[model samples]
Target: MNPIDPQHRNDWLLRAEPVEGVERIEAFFQAKAYAMHRHDTYAIGRTLAGVQSFNYRRSTTHSLPGQTMVLHPDEPHDGHAGTGEGFRYRMIYVQPALFQEVLGGRALPFIEGGVTGDPRLWAATDALLQQISQGLDPFEQGDALAELAHALAAVAGTAPARSTGDFASVRRAREYLDAQCHQAVSLESLELAVGRDRWSLSRDFRVFYGTSPYRYLTQRRLDAARAMMLRGVALAQVAASAGFTDQSHMTRHFTKTFGIAPARWLRILNGARATEILRNTAA
Candidate 1:
């Protein structure tokens, strides 16, 4: 969704439906927005107005309009407005596996200090960071991701690593995991499926996918849970359907990954929907 009426003056967040491992959000917060939390995706965005401040890597950093913020996956961070005026921004959360597709088993790129004024990054992220309501088609999204992956590598001064492992087998394993994420997937089963040893496959999975196989599976399950929640599924039922043991099991991971409880997330999303409805009615 696009930004809400500024005159309303309440914290609101609008998220685009996740598409091919990419998700985008536009949000405005008057003060503190999130508690310290980490997620297994790269958060790349730009502030649209006022000061966007967050604690990352033991220090507080601020992003203003025209600056790009590149927060590495699984890094602890918290968000708030740097001033009383509040902050507005748009962010795209990209699964590291998508970047691994471009980088080809290399280490993920990282921008130091969590924020940058680098023009290359700004340009690369422009397409993906557009209004959340204006979703990208598959081809356009693929091209934008390619540009973003390369720009991230360049701006971070990261040199390409030589191909050193069983990329083909790792790819097979990834595909298998994706297709079977809703069920229990074990390392032994993965080994049998990909024809690779469990230990070696585990290593290659991290090198090639930027996360452990278990974490990857968990994220996929979380993705399913979110989509189900948006469709008005009960939390307990969503947990069961998404392969979690129970509601509390899902709640722990959900809060850890998104930095908010499921109920609060729904509230903010519902508020955004209501605001959109109001805007349309007024128009």
Candidate 2:
């Protein structure tokens, strides 16, 4: 069965579930879906039905079914339906750290235009993007993540031979961010924790992890907020608990990061739940 029958629907329907550190979603949107926004992780997935359109890297791209989209970290982009019939697709948000684990200290691969038609990537990502309802085992997921990382680097062509980054220092900074996501973490704190000056550390971080330290912290906070929101927590409470200055501050960041407001994202989840319930009752 077609999971998303765009022609049969008149309005947007979106469903998302969190898996580990990844966010998996199947959504159909008519007309505009989201505004310009950026994220700190790679947004990778396939276009399932119709034409999935998005603006990336200063140009518009159309993703037909079976095509893979590999948006880079910290890149600004937006999405919409590419045709009058709308579009449906599934996507997974993957942290760059997972890729770093496989690449050692090499810079993350950059695939221009944010999408690809490579069969190697499709094969490598098969297990990671399976449509099954169950989650992946730790071992299984680790293997897939490793394979996908290699496939990405291979497909993006060869990188110039360069020295490995300051992996120890960068890893320490990442751990600090993971632990102190709820609190205001200063550059000095990271510097002290990693024994590298903030300026040099920031450059090393971007070279190795694909994003800046402050942006990484903000992304971690956003990740925390997403987890809380998925549990049906109140928006105001989620904002404060996620370390935002206020609800509005969180809302602005949330909208930009996820390409939709927190309230709207929650509504999409509810809509999906309702749709599933109706289908089950009929069955």
Candidate 3:
């Protein structure tokens, strides 16, 4: 099959032909950018120099030096230079199915800001950030690809074993979890919803989504609690609104996720506390 050259490189200076079975990019991109278009694979990249600006999820995010950008599959977004110097970066494409092999029935991992500064990802992706023309031997190439998938899941807070082609199960599982996050969702119920057996589904879910079904559900609740808390909702109401058993449950999940309880997270988030790195957006 002929490789597609539908890349919107006019926004930048360099564009390389798509490698068969691999969609890779390398560029010292100057100038500006075109409209956003979604890709079918995991669009993970790193900004080597300058600033990469992108309009993603309705916000203008900047990828300064030493930041990694992870554009989830089919997420509509646009890109441009974030500073006067323009931007230089490289990206790799990964199919969710491959990730599913690791996470059977789980939602796709979403790292907010579409940018990351994780040491693991930074170390794993160093080579790919070079000019896309730097060729890799077959084994090394395989390692890089595997490392990327693992790195992504790791930063997203998962490390499932065996991920290779589990997209459908994971998607189904994700939809189910997202819908029933506030309710009691059992593994048996999820199996019925996604039409996959329980154990494989659980394993796959953890790998691709970077968390177990329980964890994802908890994260959703925590997300809601954060939003409600920001709006000055009562603590009890925030707990109920987030589907937590009570303020204590919400506090437990909040503490585990943010490394502090709800009150502390709020303190840091609101700048009332001096500790830096409030939220680990790498998740």
lDDT of 3 by residue, 1-283 (tens): 1111234222233333333335565554454543565544577887766778888798988887777788876566776777655666777766565555544434566777788888888887766555654665556755676677677766887534444646667777877877887777787898899988877877776556544667766766766676688778988999987788899888766655533457744653355112212333333
In lDDT terms, which candidate is top? Answer: 1
Looking at model 2, residue 127 earns an lDDT score of 83
Global lDDT of each model?
A: 0.88, 0.82, 0.65
* Per-residue accuracy of model 2 over 72-182 as CA lDDT, tens digit each: 999999998887877777777889988887787777899988889999988887887776355667688788889999999999974743485678888999999999999
**Order the candidates by TM-score, highest first — what do you get?**
2, 1, 3
- The reply for model 2, stretches above 4 Å from the true place, is 1-17, 158-161
Error of 1 at 84 (Å): 2.0
Model 2 quality (TM-score): 0.93
Regions more than 4 Å wrong, model 1:
1-6
C-alpha TM-score for every candidate: 0.93, 0.93, 0.50
